[model samples]
Target: MKQREFLKKEKEDIRILMKFAGIYCRENHSGEKVPFAFKLFDIKKIERKEIALCSECTRLLTYGLTMRLKCPHDPKPMCKKCETQCYHSAYKAKIREVMKFSGMYLIKHGRVDMLYHYFK
Candidate 1:
């Protein structure tokens, strides 16, 4: 894929991950959360968005983004369909939990558009 395509996919993936993290953190965790600062991939636009997450969710999002950036697939396959697993087992499980919960929450709240990604 071209650099432009890769960056577009990267940005989309980042947005999805952040959305999932934000939803999970807000619903499942409590306490004072801070707005996360994203400093990777030169995504200044994303950095400006305020995504408040607990520390654990922040770490998970950071790890997820790092793993995503390091993925070797050119046209990156979905993690579940990828032959090469990039995430550590623990992180993978955590991410699955977040995705599952957030996906269902979105669907329940009328985000039918996410069904494809949720079921894929």
Candidate 2:
């Protein structure tokens, strides 16, 4: 994939994961709600949508985004299938929880189209 397309996919994946994390956070966290802008990689006008998430979710989202941006795979493989795992143990567990929970949430809610990345 070209750089542009890769970045676009990464941005969309981050947005999806963050949305899941936000849903999980809204149910669990009690801190103040905050806005997080997806403005990494100097893409300028792209991926600027702001998500309202708790501080802990925001940190997880940021960490996930950073890993996505720095990821070495082209036509990147899923994290589970990758040879190297970039996330710390705790973060890895947290992300798995978020992905699994949100994936089921989406599937149960009939958001089946959203499962392609999560399941495959």
Clashes of each: 0, 0
| Model 2 spans with C-alpha error above 4 angstroms | 1-6, 42-49
- For all candidates in order, the CA lDDT equals 0.81, 0.74
Model 1: per-residue lDDT, tens digit, 1-100?
2122336677777778888898999999999899887665554465446689999999999899888877888888878899998899999999999998
The lDDT of model 1 is: 0.81
lDDT of 2 by residue, 1-120 (tens): 224544667766766776787777776678798877555544324445556788788888878877877889888888888988888999999999988888788888898887776566
Candidate 2: which pairs clash?
Answer: none
Q: Judge candidate 2 at residue 94 and give its lDDT.
A: 94
| Candidate 1: segments with Cα more than 4 A from true spot | 1-6, 115-120
